[model samples]
Target: MSEKQYLLDKTLETWKGKRVALAVSSEHSFTGIIEDFDEEVILLRDVVDIAGNKAKALIVKIDDLNWIMLL
Candidate 1:
């Protein structure tokens, strides 16, 4: 695996079952408990969004992510 992939895998391991917020773009962000992930996307459960509403789940593309904050 590439170095970036290695680090992403490691970070994913730590993020599992933890509350995290992903910055996708200047206007979009997703916050929730990390449920699962693959090479392409992340599945989040019980997402707490910016508008302060709760969502059952959220799927975010990895390539779209700018940053992730553990909350």
Candidate 2:
């Protein structure tokens, strides 16, 4: 794999099962426990989102994220 992808995967592996907040854009975001991930998307459990949204499970695209903060 590419170095960038390797680093990303390593970071994600370390952060799995931890709580995180992901910013999709200036107007949207989600907070949850990182459940799992593959090459394409991440699975979030117990998701509670900004903008009055919530879900038991969320599958979000990796490319759609602006930033992630550990919580």
Candidate 3:
């Protein structure tokens, strides 16, 4: 895997079940506990919208992600 992919893999592995926020290029963000991830996407549980309201879940494409922040 490339460096970026390695970093992502490490992040997913180390932060599993921890709350995090993903920022996208569209300026939208999703916050949730990491549920799972694959090559193309990530599964988030107990998600919250950008406005901070709770959501059941969120599936976000990996390519759309700009950054990840631990919360």
Candidate 4:
């Protein structure tokens, strides 16, 4: 696997079955369970909030991820 893929795999493995904070464009933030992950993106479900309201979100392309915090 490529270095990027390896890193993504490692990150996913480390963060699996955990909640993470996602920061998207427009400074939107959401907390959700990490349902699944791939080289390109992470699938999050059971979204709790976005900026301040209940919402569901799909984060595409790990490169677009500004940051992820396990909690």
Using lDDT as the measure, which candidate wins? 1
Q: Model 1 segments beyond 4 Å from truth?
A: none
Candidate order by decreasing lDDT: 1, 3, 2, 4
What are the models' TM-scores?
0.92, 0.89, 0.87, 0.75
Listing every candidate in turn, what is its Cα RMSD in Å to the true structure after a full C-alpha superposition? 0.9, 1.3, 1.3, 2.1
lDDT of each: 0.90, 0.88, 0.89, 0.77
Off by over 4 Å in 2: none
The reply for model 4, stretches above 4 Å from the true place, is none
Residues 11-57, candidate 2: write the lDDT tens digits: 99999999999987566798999999987898999999886687899
Clashing pairs in 3: none
Of 1 and 2, which scores higher on lDDT? Answer: 1
Q: Write the per-residue lDDT of candidate 4 for residues 1-71, one digit (tens) a residue.
A: 99978886988888887888877653667788898887778888777766466657566567777777887
Residue lDDT tens for model 1, 1-71:
89999899899989899999888866787799999999899999999878899999999988989999898
Which structure is stronger by TM-score: 3 or 4? 3
Per residue, candidate 3 scores C-alpha lDDT tens digits across 1-71 of 89989988997989889999888777888899999998899899999887889888888999999988888
Better of 1 and 3 by TM-score: 1
**49 Cα displacement, candidate 1 (Å):** 1.0
